[model samples]
Target: MDIAILSVSLNVHSTKRIVEEGQKAGHYVELIDHTKCSVKLGEGKPQIYLGEENVTDEFDAIIPRIGAKVTKHGAAIVKQFEMNNVFSTARSLGIMRARNKIRTLQIMARKGIPIPETLFSINPHNIGEQIELLGGPPVIIKLQEGTHGSGVILAESKKSAKSIIDTFYKMDTSILLQKYIEEANGEDIRIIVVGNKVVASMKRISDLDDFRSNVHRGAETEAIKPTAKEQFIALNATKYLGLGVAGVDIMRSKKGPVLIEVNASPGLQGIEGATGVNVAQQIIQFVEKNGHRSRK
Candidate 1:
């Protein structure tokens, strides 16, 4: 099978590993930089171009490693492939929904998946009330599209929370406020789901000085076997989001496990290293099963 890894660069660790694994599996794989791709729509079927080359029918499947900054354009390219009847690890709509925190949470909440009490409002006048709605003080304020814990903030007091939220609203930045799980102790679970199976999971402990438990934020990671309920939540979250591959983040709270986020194009470096799983190969095999089946 021929595969295309839709990413901005092949130099990225995940992208390189995927290409390596696909080769090791005896499949032809190439990196297609979605950022440099263009789409052409005419009287005939739409065509996707990489520079001057037409790529409409060049591959059997696509593994989109779309980044946060280029999600819209990247998802568009993926959507074009979907229209061409090409199999993709992630659906276009799934990428769009997963890119936004509020959208993902809304879908999760509606699907009866457990999640923290999250609220989003654009009204500057009701900033105080919005914070109070979450029961106030020590709330988790997060950017709607932030990745790797860059825009997540922990406000320890009502005064600070109000100020930070008001400032965000005034600047017209999209954010969400959630009830902070104080018992979490700066730790969270990262579960990697390939197809319908939970391939790997790990517990991420945040730095002593930081509350965000992202590996990119200097968090330490160790392998973990998720409980049956946690495993169920991770798998269902991937299914509801329409993602064949995902990294589902959950925080262990007094109310059991609450999903904090779901990543459409989950990075393989942290989870792979922590769990000692060949996640890249699992992705390749998933493609092998579904990619050929889609051709039927």
Candidate 2:
């Protein structure tokens, strides 16, 4: 099979691993930097290009490892591939939905998936009311498109929450507020789903001084077997978002397990290393099944 890993660079650990595994699986895999890709429309058939090279029909499948910074362009490129009948691990719409916390949460809420109590608003006039909606502070504030725990904030007091939320509203930055689950204790679950099944899962423990349990935030990880409920949520979340591969993040609250977010372009490094699961290979195999069917 001819596969393309749509990413910024082959130097990224996850990107490199996928390329190696795809090659080992006897497939011709290439790294197509979506940043350099463009599309031409209204010429009868849409055409996609990589710099000077036309890539309209270059591959049978694409595994997009899109970054938060280039999500729009990357999803556009992936959309072009979809329009051209190429199989992709993530659909274009799914990429966009997963990029924003509000959008993802909306879908999850509509689908009856358990998620943290979340609220979003743009009105700065009622900052206190907004915080009150989530039952006041110790609230979780998150930038809509934050990645790797970069824009998540914990406001431990009403004053701090009001100030932070007002600042975001005044600046026109998109953010969401959620009731912090103190029981989680800075720990969360990451379940890697490929083709309707959970291939691997891990528990991420945040550093003592931090509340975010992201691997990039220097968190510790250990392989974990997700409970049946957690597995159900992860699989359904991926399906609802139209993604063949994803990382579903969950936190065990006092009530039960609630989803925090779903990542369309989930990184393979931490999950793979912690679980000793060849998640890259699972991705390749998923593509192999669906990529062939798409061709048919």
The sequence of per-residue lDDT tens digits that candidate 2 reaches over residues 147-198 is: 9998999999999999998999889999999999999999999999999899
lDDT of 2 at 130: 84
lDDT of each: 0.94, 0.93
Regions of model 1 farther than 4 Å from truth: 293-296
User: Once superposed on the true structure, which residue ranges of model 2 sit more than 4 Å away at CA?
Assistant: 293-296
Q: Model 1: clashing residue pairs?
A: none
Q: What TM-score, to 2 decimals, does candidate 1 have?
A: 0.98
Q: Using Cα atoms with residue i matched to residue i, what is each candidate's TM-score against the true structure?
A: 0.98, 0.98
Worst 10 residues of 2 by lDDT: 287-296
lDDT of 1 at 221: 99
